[model samples]
Target: MAETRSTTAPRVVRREPTLTGELLAEFAGTAILILFGVGVVAQVVAGQNGDDDSIHWAWGLGVTFGVYVAGRTSGAHLNPAVTVALAVFKGFAWRKVLPYSVAQLLGAFVAALIVRWVYADAIATVDPRTTFDSQGIFSTLPGAGVSIGTAFLDQVVGTALLVFLIFAVTELRATPPAANLAPFIIGLIVVAIGFAWGSNAGYAINPARDLGPRLASFLTGYSTAMREPGGQFYFWVPIVAPLIGGVLGGGLYRVLVERHLPDQTDAEQPTGRIPAEDD
Candidate 1:
């Protein structure tokens, strides 16, 4: 037989996405989140019609759609506080933290600009006595008589509840939602927090959510945006408090819930008999 050689092509392996792609998704998702979130606030403030319940649902649905937009690529960590929480407790890469946070902030800032432009006519018509009067549409304002310390505590507690419930709902060992309903459940959590926790200082559980738009307001003629009515510089509270709260909340979940849950694989294994505890 004549000598014959067979040619075989080398296997090609697919590569993962670059950090830039993930950052883009994070930016886009957060921008969409802020667009809807701030749009609702503009409607309520400038339109003078929407109630707090409407605000809650607007933010909830904003988060739901934002997650659906970015969950596959960036895990929809549209909040810097959320990104930090996942990094510290959920094995996310520490190297990507700053980039992710920056992307989120940029997204919020851009979204605020868009919202401001879209509502420019309404804003001009509703042009209140002062720029400070309209500032709440873009950022949180501490309620009358609410001290900075109290506001900070509210953020901490609210964020703790938010992050803890997130850890619980997303835990594989725990009874996580099936049928890809996690995003909707997460949105409901935001709604619940808004209903129960948004009285004192506008339930800003995410740093970037507050800071980025606040900066936009400050630049857009709200000179007092960074300060409270009581002459206190209130801009830092939402940022700092949520970061601390996120760490605390994630740690609490890891300690209380995750550590105590039965391993999923071990629990699912066939044993041919019920455990003594069940008996």
Candidate 2:
């Protein structure tokens, strides 16, 4: 018999990706994350769903819950922006980023599904009819008057400040409380950022936080609102800026300050606040 080579390409089996414990962490983190996040915005801005007055403070509690739930597992990048920054700045493994992101997005979608189910009647009753952009809806809007370049720069600088602070308080491993204190401290920082700079571009700071919710909102059937036409939405900024800021922040810390990494014992639960005084 004459030797005949097959014309078709050789079949190389692509090994299927398997779900692991890390995936669960990502899912759990993203779910509780959107719950606290969107749940807060829904309570305030959604008319019957959002009260505007009391919902704001309840928003704080939501932040606290989000961190407690997601902190240990997957470090809760709930936002894509944070995930990018984590890899670049904190030395989080690159291999994990895509999986974490997919998990985060899926988690957000599931969480949104749950919220929609809970507020089905509320969602239908609203006069104007809004898709649940609750998480990104009230939080940030794009800069109306600025040029695209300026707007982009603003997001980068603003998000960097936010992420940098995170690195300082958390990555510096300032003390035993730094890890446990993650939720409260992060929530407070967000509160301040919203008050000061959130007006333009929503102070998203974390891409996963906003983008995941935004994606869920769009997928679940909110119109062009989340899309933010003409880059007026500035979604790209939130995604890009934070990564830049996070790296800058990390670099600054490495150069300016000496690292005094906290021990494993620091993660243990404690009785009182770790003194804020810097050593």
Candidate 3:
């Protein structure tokens, strides 16, 4: 033969996403969430352009989109309470919990910083002193006549409802929603919680959602960010109560619903849905 020529295309090998990739997904997802959430709050409080209902819907939509962004890569444990709940009940890796939580916290912090920068003029005009009133634009605070104990209980109940419904809707054996629909349903759960319990402490059912912005506010001259207007240390309630509520909710779901579901063979198990457990 005078000449032989081959024109085969090269094979492209795809690798699975690593933990680092997952962390990045979580970080980005949470940043998207906080950007919408904190930005909306800033608009309402600082810019005075919206109302309470507006805040609830925006936050819900934020959660929905956040989950959609990171669900495939990281199982989208955007809330540390969710991460902790999965580890406690659903066999998520314990070693990854702290990393995931840190990533989420950092994402919220960065997003809050961006919101602060964007709304700096409005905030400064409304409350030049950066007092507790201005701080509410970034993080949650107790409502009028709400005591610390009541706020803690509100968080516990709100987060319990969140985790309980999350477990219910994600359980493989249960009639779970389609993977595409699960995130929207979860978002509705947050909205419902906000409508029912937000008045107590603005429904800070996720610790990172509160603490990250609180810290950002503190650094940006809100001296009362870490405390209530009355000067009582109130930062711990959102962090601690939601965690307890997550575990309790997951446990309750397991005992009451999941345990009673009919078992499925390995071959019958579904794939490509939003996984109830982390990878």
Candidate 4:
């Protein structure tokens, strides 16, 4: 019998991702995120528009900066679902993935809490005669006769579209756009969803962007309109739907493009928030 040996290259030792440190980075990033979303509510409610379209513009710009800054450092996920999706696709580590998600959600919740304190008075003015359903503040509403299923469909469909768009731009684009402009591009994506589908679902694309504030609003004791007439039972769509859509989108990228990437598991050299720049 002849002895045969196989030749394979050894895996390289890379620097650890520093999950704890990433949490700190994510927390700071999420603070800015909530500040924008919650701040917009306060601004709009407090009449900061001042005869101009201040609220939407302010939020758009705010989100752009936050994503850019955090993305430059911590990958700017800020949302658990996004993190989870990336991890599932192996863009991030499985070991730190769960902790990262926990940190992201906690960060958003804490940010929401602070925003509640900051925007207390403004939220208080949303008519004490009505309950303040925080989720609806960022989305559209269903009429009295609309079924619960219909409302859920709105969230599901809107979130699916959002995840699909994000995947298209981030993964499948033939050419990666300018690094500095990626966040701006993401902001524009949200804006488009908000405008196109917003009329139906208010387009709650990001889960952290919604659940964080909703929990904070309830905990802060400023809401009077918590239970609207739209059968507000299916709030999970915003959280779950996007994740589902993101996975599908990532799979689409892998099948259509990543398979052809120089290194399917890791192609682009991540620039901290950017994907690995080292091949």
Better of 1 and 2 by TM-score: 1
Worst 10 residues of 2 by lDDT: 270-279
Model 3 agreement with the true structure over 1-279: per-residue lDDT tens digits: 689778898899978679899999999999889998999999999999999999999999999999999988898888999999999999998999999999999999999999999899999999999987778888888899999999998888889889999998888777888878888999999999989888989998999999899898889989888899778999899899999999989899889998899998878766555454654
Over the stretch 123-233, how does candidate 2's per-residue lDDT look in tens digits?
555624563344344234565665656656767766667666666656434442455777787767666666666556655666666666666556665665455545345
TM-score of each: 0.89, 0.70, 0.93, 0.74
Q: Which residue pairs in model 3 clash with each other?
A: none
The runs of at least 3 residues in candidate 3 whose Cα sits more than 4 Å from the true structure, single-residue gaps closed, are: 1-14, 266-271, 274-276
lDDT of 1 by residue, 1-279 (tens): 999887888889977557898899889989988998999999998888798899999999998888888776677889888888888888788888899999999999999988888887888788744376678888887888899999999999888888888878777666777626878888999999999989899998999899989988877767888998878899999999998888889899989878888765766743322100111
RMSD of 2: 12.9
TM-score ranking, high to low: 3, 1, 4, 2
lDDT score for residue 2 of model 4:
100
The prediction achieving the highest lDDT against the true structure is: 3
- After TM-score superposition, the amount by which residue 250's alpha carbon in candidate 1 deviates from its true location, in angstroms, is 0.6
Predictions in order: lDDT: 0.84, 0.60, 0.89, 0.59
Question: Given candidate 4, what's the lDDT at residue 60?
Answer: 58
Instruction: Give all candidate RMSDs, comma-separated.
Output: 6.7, 12.9, 2.5, 9.2
